[model samples]
Target chain A: MFDMEPEVLERFTWYMREQSALTIMFHTKVAEQMGLSATDEKCLDLAMRADGPLTAGRIAELSGLSTGAVTGVIDRLERAGFVRRVRDPHDRRKVLVEVTAGDLAKFAHLFEKAQQSLVQVLSRFDPDEIEVIERYLQLQIETFRKAVINT
Target chain B: MFDMEPEVLERFTWYMREQSALTIMFHTKVAEQMGLSATDEKCLDLAMRADGPLTAGRIAELSGLSTGAVTGVIDRLERAGFVRRVRDPHDRRKVLVEVTAGDLAKFAHLFEKAQQSLVQVLSRFDPDEIEVIERYLQLQIETFRKAVINT
Candidate 1:
């Protein structure tokens, strides 16, 4: 339904592909630093980002990993002190995976550096430009998620 | 060196994190469809993105996988028809990993869908806003890469 000039479309595609590669590399580094395998680190990220603790099944769904694989990830994460298994208070029979707060604080410097880089990038744009950028990010994320799900 | 309101920074951080998570999931699904492990696919990606064929040592460096691990990844990818090893023309004793182009073309629909999503996102903005977004993406990629490497 939307039309873009071929060259412009090609440039944007390159940017998206570059961003994707860099993101994967960033996660690999983060996972290495946390002493967790990439899969385990990704599962922990799912738990950390959730509004509350997640069941192993929920993490499996979010990470696109098998339930059995998620169980192993949780086991390793628990041993690494990055997460813990707790009975869901709202449902006593349900086990939930919760990220351990204090331990992740040790990795603050890494995330802070990322935040600082973001601040630097944002600073170059005025309020109006920043607004446009924000809108673009929101739309891009929404559209890309739909594309990925359909894939 | 730059200042941003706490809330704006927080929002941007959330976007970055969400994008990162989605990218990982996309890679996982793509790998599953290609019958390769996530790590092998990542290595193959490194080879594919290079300007020319890469030696196994180069792939190992770029992917953060050990040399031995990269060897296994190459072996698997070769068997799966995603990549092949060839003697470097400049030095016959050296082996290089090269992506097999025809096979990846079979997955064009997935990538084309992703490209279409980008087109849709960009079509919402005027030319000036598109320029701002492009600059933002370039800086974000550069700064994020530095952050990732330093991490």
Candidate 2:
């Protein structure tokens, strides 16, 4: 039953593959421009978006990175003066990560510019089309989240 | 003009960002499983999808990677036993990249399984909805492609 419409399935697969590649290319380019690895950039993004400094474990969870991986990413960001690691005053065993103000000022323009570029590209589609894509993506992410939990 | 529903715009941006991260996670997982770097895995994918062995320049162009970057990717793949660098017989100046049989066999199963996983996730949406999402993605890619070209 699942074997229906081989050609359509193939096209869908190719489309997904190409879209994925294009995304990687854009990310790599932006990361290079910022002198950061893609992972490090993502960690900084997660930190900046948080309401306040977040614990390492929370950052790892938010970024969908492992704790050990987040540690390395934080280390790199710290070395680059983009982030700082602070010991949680109340809980000595916990450490909080925060993006540096200097880094925020440096990256803010570029980040906004990137979003503007993306918006311009997406402007080709009508509002309804954009809404459909956004909803579809949300559904896709939820499905993956469920898969991860079940596994 | 840019302030058209700020909340909706923010949601759209987050959707793109999350989709981008999801793609990187998917590629990174597959590459790690294959004992290859993400870039090398991408080169192998391009070679497999191409009709014949591709020149470094062509691979770089098709992959949206710089020629020098593609060279480095091919070099790593060559070292990892997944791909071989072949000099064009007729045009000695051109180096053609080809995937190894062992690598192809390994990638074939992984690729199919990944596609099945994606299809499973996408299947929740009706066919019309899937088509709408696909069309939006195609338009997005085309817009980005033109941006790259114009820039």
Clashes of each: 0, 0
**How far in Å is the alpha carbon of A54 misplaced in model 2?**
4.1
The numbered model that scores best in TM-score is 1
Docking class of 2: acceptable
Error of 1 at A133 (Å): 0.3
Best by lDDT: 1
lDDT of 1 by residue, A26-67 (tens): 888888888888888888888989998888788888877788
| Predicted structure with the largest DockQ when compared to the true one | 1
Model 2 / residue A112 / CA error / Å: 4.6
Question: What lDDT tens digits, residue by residue, belong to model 1 across residues B45-88?
Answer: 88888898899998888887789998899899899898889988
- Fraction of the true interface contacts (Cα pairs closer than 8 Å across chains) found in each model: 0.78, 0.33
